[model samples]
Target chain A: MKIKREYMELGALATLALVLLVAFPLLLGGFYLNLAGKYLSFAFVAIGIVLTWGYGGILSLGQGIFFGLGGYALAMFLKIEASGSNLPDFMIWSGIKVMPAWWAPFSNIYITLAAIVLIPATMAFVFSYLVFKKRVSGVYFAIVTLALALTFTVLLVGQQSYTGGENGITNFTTFLGYDIYSHASTYAIYYTEIVLLLFVAMGSTAVIRSRLGNVVIAIRDREDRVRFSGYNTAAIKAFIFMLGALFASIGGAFFTIQAGLISPTVVGVTSSIEMVVYAAVGGRLSVPGAVLGALVVGFLQFYLSNNFPHIWLFFLGALFILVVTAMPNGLMGLLDRFALSRE
Target chain B: MELMQGQQGVIFDGANVPAARRGHCELSIRNLSVSFDGFKAVDDLSLHIAQDELRVIIGPNGAGKTTLLDMICGKTRPMAGQIFLNDLNLTNLSDFNIVRAGVGRKFQNPSVYEDLSVAENLEISIPRGRGALASLFFRRTKVVKEEIRDMARIVFLDDLLDRRAGHLSHGQKQWLEIGMLLMQAPKLLLLDEPVAGMSPREREQTAELLKVLSVGRSVVVIEHDMDFVRSIAHTVTVLHQGRLLVEGSADEVQADPRVIDVYLGH
Candidate 1:
């Protein structure tokens, strides 16, 4: 634990939340527990976004690719298991008797887990290596990462025969013999997600506090100076990009279990953009800020759509701008200021 | 110290750059040119630096002095021509590689990591490099910590060791930057406006520091401070309109008619 003293404060908070999460499922009942499970995954996604945008000073707009990859890993295995005939139902329904070679890896949980972690990290690596190595930063970085997300969404949308496509792969829930819809199962998943979220939050805190973190902030403040100081800036950026992707994929994997499905709609261009929005709305620096931002945004969407579903995205856009234009550092900054003044 | 052991009453003013081996090739530039878009920032310029000579490049504004330093340090590549350092051709060398090859640079701005404590900043500077992770595990094994402290004492910043670098006064920040560069232990130090905004007393002390620094290493300094340049430069290379107009000893160059005209007219 002392190997990383950087994230100690955030670790404390995360530990507190984790205890609450583990206990809440049993105390609060199944429906609410599943909703809380959804929150942890969302928290992971926000932490991932923060690593790039908040710390590395990278403008990544395509976190959805990793999220989608994680979701697809679980979805593919679940579907394959459900079919019980080697090929998932979609491939058979589309007149393709053979499963794609790419889908073969998800049959084993180890491979699926590796895919959950590595695929997104790899995507981040390749994309960020190409971009940051060329010194593409600022809005240029934003555009390229967003473009990647857009491409993934388009690919998923068109691949209806293999994937579920626009309608998405949803319903028929169970993971490794546990019923996804079961009350205990929901609590189990929620607890697992909370643990993952705690780690991401703690990991990011350590990263920001480490010497590597100093280099990150230095790169943010003065890239030319860091370069002159003999750091391979592109390599550092790649490292952070991969780290962010890992967090995003973890969130995506948990997202699949909570929602019990995977599809293009959930992990699309807009979803990628929404990741940035959460970071921006979360104050972009603190781990707690990201978690808070995700929770607030998630609740806002859930409630607004529950009332007037048609204007939900519009409300989202407006809220984002309002928060950005006014608060700048998100709700935590606001809360901190309020508490300070009162004291 | 041994160089002067053979001679009696040798003056030590940091003006001696280490002598190069007869044919080692320290740095060579040929028809180097760099442009931004259509504008010629530095055009058709060429220069050579001896193995360990501390040479001062003095030029007026827009003389491409900074740009020239940039080329030497691999911060910018020439649109035309090649830059060579020792055995290696450096035109294609990346920023970090160039530094790794011992071509370190200090910018005019004091760009130290602001939030880090002075000791922490110094701790990071020891150049354990690329994988500082392993270096951290073996921090005490390295001599960098002691060296950093020794350097702080040399720079007269030993007392400010625990203070954050950002809290330092302007001149103190500068000494910290120089200390950071010293931590690199570079072969050829490329300095751009090292004493631009210092107080008079600070400027005098900096001139003294530069003099001490020139004894054993090669330094390519871009400076507009004529008096400071006069005090420290072994040989002054005057630049005008992105060209090397003349090169000579400080006193000899100051008396040159063209040098006077360019310095006055600009």
Candidate 2:
């Protein structure tokens, strides 16, 4: 690998990472490919935190709100597309006469995809503007956003007729008249998912390397100084929040396409917090750290549960605690420190 | 558009302040008071910083000097007072807004992000100073480059632009903070202990830099180093118990009997 000397000698590691990213999805068996796809989506959420929370110093736990909202938006579209003549699987059980008016716009694939991007971006724009403009920061900021995620999930669960209540919009989605249940179709979905995942990673990396990326870091370290320098911080933060939300939504939409299902639990508060853990484990500033965090956590969740089903969660908690206290910088930070010590 | 940034180039005199009226919008503080609960950290303070004026504030530990700077920078809101920056009202604005109103501040501790490169720190503060966005498309505009170059030249940081701010010397870090303030290009620059932990040589250089930069903008510096205060300060303001003890030329204030007895406590 061609290494840049100044990356703390990390350029080789980054190149090796790129090679593995492209190769892993291809070489892994069908089961692992699906697993990796899920990991990629978690990374999407991590990137969101990296931008708004990590770089801009806005600790937004409410990212899951956008993540799930994007999931639901796309899920609503797939259900409508699949319904064709018969009512969606959940709607028949819920005893609804006809589809709701809100579901009508999603009937067009173009509009649904547009809504997927536009709606979430717009919401982030408004929400972030309000919070940052008020200068609600630190512990209070975290609590408020966490509350937003909780309140949003509760709303999804409460809207029985529209949102399918706690069950969420699931048992729907077919990619252009093809049944997604077959193994071949899943493989196809897997490759497509990989492509999207790569794009998301590359896109985020590009942004982080750009000039505006500097502002995000500046905002994180010194807001007073930055503001005095003449930047509209609230506006910068809101813009980044919206961008992060759009990425998560795209990830969520990909997630739905793969599973042929959508539900509240996947995008719930617990899941939102899980994204935080993944980012933390991978280390916040390291883009690759997020992927590593998601992959390791996901692998552990899958493997440990299978062998030690009863004590698995306890093990996971113990692992997380160890990681948090001992390796606050996460796996990447540890690796970096170890590498530094050697050099 | 390109040259507007150069208009404020390297000078310390606040007279360059673009004003609605004939005189520039130099900083004016009247009866400013800040309290932590009821402690009155800064009480009934009034001061003014003129254009291109390098004014040094000195007091013993816990004398409310830092609090005075904090209030002016909009980091802390005073219970009662009016702050006019070039005649623009600043009483109701938040920290960011006040920063936008044309005031720059350097923290006592190095606030630059260690994880980021020096160039990255420069890039981040510049867009804000130039009123640009942190979007993907925001390249370094011509004005941004000129401003960054000008700041780098003053701090002798031109060669270390690509290096991380974290790896800098104590002196370099102080210069980086000042560079950040220059990116802010505020009419009044508020510095908190610019050379608290530097070597004697570094402190002397900082003293010289302050005197050099004070030609076109208003600057308020807080210092414990008596010599530094004497060297750079055109006017001296002594703060004690969050209030002003006396204000005049550095020598006059130093010789004042009241300033020594109550404010300096020497």
Candidate 3:
């Protein structure tokens, strides 16, 4: 039987992911595990970018808005839980007596979780519907999304009483009755994040390999042709974009729980563009590549910002330019070339 | 159904289509006019195409041949017009909705997905799981696979199904695009300069394929190749300055003095 190259490559990737997931926890401890957990959560957003921008051909530069929205939602729930029906410290500091109506539903964990996914999905639906209905796409769509992120950041920063301002929602002591600060809880979060990341990566691979994936890519290549071939182009784009938003939201939720904070800084234009860079460096079209890109970039940022804080920004800018020029397909493309040459 | 009943030419309601009028008017346009800025691209154009008819549209460069197709396919909405595709009023519909109403369109350029394989390209146009939820868990059954193979066979790409569409020769890419359209099983196929870049041999094959395709559907071919048009066209519609100059058999159109003066004269 002739083995398709795609199947072989997928098999190799799955094996690699399995090995990494099982071995990483054993090799790393304490601070490293916590850091890896955070990175894994960030991978959710990167994988989402792969599905939307890479596959669907919808480049959203404001994904930080969705990520921030999700993280903030979960953070609110966690905050209220920590507060035990009382007003959060920031709200009290801002001289607010009553809990905001929006913050009331989040006191229930299930509602908060739903909002974490629904908020971004709803926002995506409204935003995508309006934009795509008018047939606005390409760079215009990117600019709109970027503007949204910027606007959202400003709004979050300005609303000190409701949003806790630039400091964001923080100082959470518990998550679902577990003492999040305890070593056992941190390990649980790390393991859960790793498992979720692996599943998400696998799920995305399945999606990209499905029949819908072909149509999505076709829309990316020749949208008019796909439309004339009887597929609703805008609806398809909206669906994929919404799915991407949901993934980012889920990642945000995970980040809030693991890191014990959700801040406006992560939802701003800078971090939003950084998410795309992760996808670009990993291999925008490859699911596993997106995950690897997130981990590598996340780790590098942590290390470089610590050791050479002043040079980190310059290094990142240079690296982005180099990757875009020299390796447009990213680390996966490089690895693919090496593999093909070896073969 | 309402649009089909009130048209000038023979019209068939989709549900009650008579056996004798199987080739009834599939597409009917009335008083269609469109302008881009100050220039009138398609001015007061009206045309009726019957089912199973292979109608060829020939025009000079700025004669609005592409714009006509664009309007029909809902890529460009007419400033004033009514377009009916049997039971559907296609004038106000979006491009995809118009397509769903059984109007398939091919552009002047071969526009297959370059990054995908020939089989994948064909698979995308197979009208299943069109909704978001259904597409999420779309599974390819054996029947769908066989159908894709059949479409590939029709386009002469059965052997090249695994090859990337971008790697195909220009003629092959054109055929792949036509195959993609065919996979949707549309009632009407609007081809805009399909054989524009094809070799004579490929053109001949395309003509033969299009003739076979017209057995169960309507086909509108917009081409500059008079020889190719004469070979397959049952009727020829000549357009000069976005207005219909004449409509007749191939020889009649070729011999028309008005056609020569306006289009062939150039």
Candidate 4:
């Protein structure tokens, strides 16, 4: 029987999920598992990049803003909960007696969860409307998003007391009344991240196969054709961009939970560009390729930082250039060509 | 070609749009003008298309043939003028809204999505639940499948529906684009240079397709191919220096002395 390409993709995703969710946890010890969890969280952002930059053709250079927002929202809530009516440690250290008015809503876990999804999506919606509605696209859109990331990083760094003064929010103890530092909690968080990643992968695949995804691709290729076909191209672009932001925000929220910290470094311009590199290295157009890209890049960064230390950045830069120049479609395209090769 | 079941009812939602008079003039453009810097691309051009009319526009390279279609489809905003489809004004509406208001345009170059298959291209163009949410949850129902199949057959692409549009020949891409436009079931179809890169056999097929397409709809075609226009044109409109020189049947327009001096003679 002839197998459809989409089915083959689904099979590959299932196998990957089985390995990551089942085999990795059973085989790897605590340290490696935790590291893998961190890498998997990056996969969320990579998947988002595929949707926005890869599919919708809206290259957002500042996905870190959404990720940071989601991470901070959860971190702020946890910090407040750990304070037990006292000010968060950073506020007290900075000599502020009162918690800011904005931080009050994050005290409720429900609200923080909602904010994790809504905040980034809202930012995306606003930015996309302002720019895409005006018919701005290509490099102009990229520059605007990059500027946004830079400005936001500066703002977070400048607001030292509230944002942990560049050191970022750290020292987590409890989450949802469970001890997050314990081995069981670490395992739970790892499993949770894996499950969420799989869910996002499947959901994104469904979307990419849907009419929405088709139209988004069409708009990416030929915007005027899509617009003349009676589609609100701006709205479609905005929606996909917003979805990308939502995925990144979710990833950010998990990053804080897994790493026990939310820092300005993660939301910086360098980090945003790094996230794009992950997508580009994976296969911008392939969701699974994006996930693998994040995993590979994350693992390489970990290994390189410990082994080569100073040379890691240069290595990454070379990798990016090579991927762009030599393999424009990234690792997935390479794998696809191999799969289609019949000698 | 017959429309799919349940498609005709929603073709024009009278509640949100003005009712279209079947036998009357379908598209009315009044005093339309758009200038780039001080250069007039289109200057005070007025045109009318009765229901089911196939109007062919022939002109020189810079005679504003494309700008005319661009203005009608809202790709380029006109400096002064009103475009009315049926009784609804379409001048200030955005590109997508103008399309939803019953005008589908095909660009000079075949603009179908290269990455998508021919069927998928037609599916996206079908105006079923066009909102972001609607498209997200869109399912291929029986009507949608039949509509796609019927459109594919109409465009001579039924056997190649699963082929990627990028893999198609130049003529096939043109047919695919026309198929996509027909999927919308648009009342006014604006085509710009549809046969620029087509073979002679393909041009004959397109002419036949356009004849059937204009049965229940109005078509405006801009082309440089005089032989193709002669075979397909119901009325030929000559444009020269951003203005209409003459409007008559194909033979009559060919015989006009001013048309010969300005356009055909050169």
Top lDDT model:
4
Q: Compare candidates 1 and 3 on DockQ and give the better one.
A: 3
| Model 2 ranges off by over 4 Å | A1-32, A52-62, A138-140, A182-188, A222-225, A325-343, B1-25, B31-46, B59-64, B127-136, B140-150, B156-163, B239-245
Q: Which ranking of candidates, highest lDDT first?
A: 4, 3, 1, 2
Candidate ordering by TM-score (highest first): 4, 3, 1, 2
CAPRI grade, predicted model 3: medium
Expressed as tens digits, the lDDT of each residue in A9-60 for candidate 3 is: 5875676577566777678886887887887777899999999999998999
lDDT of 2 by residue, B76-135 (tens): 788998898876888888777787777788889867767676656766665343333435
Please provide, for model 1 over A205-323, each residue's C-alpha lDDT reduced to its tens digit, 9 standing for 90 to 100. Answer: 76776677777777776777787778888888888888888888888888887988778878888878887788778778767778877777877888899999788889999999998
Native interface contact recovery, all models: 0.38, 0.61, 0.79, 0.95
Better of 2 and 4 by DockQ: 4
The CA lDDT of each predicted structure is: 0.75, 0.74, 0.84, 0.87
Tens digits of per-residue lDDT for model 2 on A31-145?
7777777667777788677666666677777778888877888888778767778767766777888877887788778888898889999998898789888877777877887
User: Per-residue lDDT for A128 in model 3?
Assistant: 98
lDDT of 3 at B9: 21
The complex in candidate 3 yields a DockQ of 0.64
Model 4: lDDT of residue A117: 89
Provide DockQ values for all models, in the order shown. 0.40, 0.43, 0.64, 0.84
Candidate 4 lDDT over A1-343, as tens digits, reads 0134576678769888988988998999988888888888889999999999999888988999998998899999889888887999889988998889999999999999999988889988887977898999999999999999999999998899999969899987899789888899889999888888899999999999899999999999988778888988888999999989999999999999888898989988899999999999999988888889998999999988999997888999999999999988899878776776742
- Candidate 2 chain A has its poorest 10 consecutive residues by lDDT at A1-10
Give the per-residue lDDT of model 3 (tens digit) for B1-266. 22122232222133244424444448898999999997899989999998778999998999999999999998998999899988679989988888888888898988889988898888777777777667768778776777777677778888998898899999999999898887776778999888888999999989888887775578899999899999999999998888898999999999999999888878
